[model samples]
Target: MKKSYRIKKDVEFQKVFKQGASFANRQLVIYYLHKNDQPHFRIGLSVSKKVGNAVERNQIKRYIRQAFTELQCEIKNEYDMIIIARKPVKACNYHEVRRSVEHLLFKTKLLNK
Candidate 1:
């Protein structure tokens, strides 16, 4: 098991929900909003019951947290991110999840921008 990227009690999530915009690719839906602080990225994961039961949901969350941790060094700052796991995620592997997140990050200009 891995420790999750702690989603602090900051206003980032609320800002995103109220003002941030979203863009989705084939694998994931990324909702992002810029903040005033220096390069801090908070991640939130959403897995619906339609994806699976408690066991499956937990598995998906673990995988997502792992993926984010793996990319921590490469990710940029000052953005709040929300990743919503779709049904396809349940059938995907860790690498697939990683690649999916990477693609979104790259596409959204969160890296090297």
Candidate 2:
């Protein structure tokens, strides 16, 4: 994903957490805030150390980014989103990760149906 499409700042993530609408499933939680000022979607992933060691956390984040990349075109634009992965997510493969992410996005109505 491009830099413009990734939410990179602490403040931005905080804003989403505080003001965005949220949804969740067993594996993931999604928080989204609509931004009429922007023309693209920005996403951030949160995988804590509780999920695993550095390697496992990085792997999960990579899978999430890949999933988000694939789903980007179908996602509604002009939103800032945060995806939080639970510890169980570390056990998931890419396909599982993608499915869980997609499921949460749909539940949140972030993906355009």
Candidate 3:
């Protein structure tokens, strides 16, 4: 994901965690907060050490990023989003990761149809 599209600061993630509405499935949890001033989307991903060692964690993050990239056009702007990987995600593959991400987004009811 591009720097411009990612939520990089600790403050940003904390804000989303504290104030955003959330949705989750077995593999992913998504939090989102709408904003009128931003006019763009900011995505933050959290794949913790508990999910696996470094390689597995990085691979899962990559899969989630790719899934978000594919769905970028279909998602509305002006929102801050945080995606957290669940423990079961350690054993999954790309397609499954993508499906999990998409499923969580759908549950949010904020994605463009």
- Order by lDDT, highest first: 2, 3, 1
lDDT of 1 by residue, 36-105 (tens): 7754677877779999999999988888888887788778867778888888888888889888888889
Model 1 clash pairs? Answer: 39-77, 39-78, 40-78
Candidate 3 lDDT score at position 82: 95
Better of 1 and 2 by TM-score: 2
Please list the residue runs of candidate 3 whose C-alpha ends up more than 4 Å from where it truly belongs after superposition. Answer: none
Model 3 compared with the native: what TM-score? 0.95
Of 2 and 3, the candidate ahead on lDDT is 2
In order, the Cα lDDT scores of the candidates are 0.78, 0.90, 0.88
Give the Cα RMSD of candidate 3.
0.9
Tens digits of per-residue lDDT, candidate 2, 1-113, equal 89889988999999999998998888888999999999989998888888899999999999999998999889999899999999789778999999998898888788789
Answer with 1 or 3, whichever has the higher TM-score: 3
The lDDT leader among the candidates is: 2
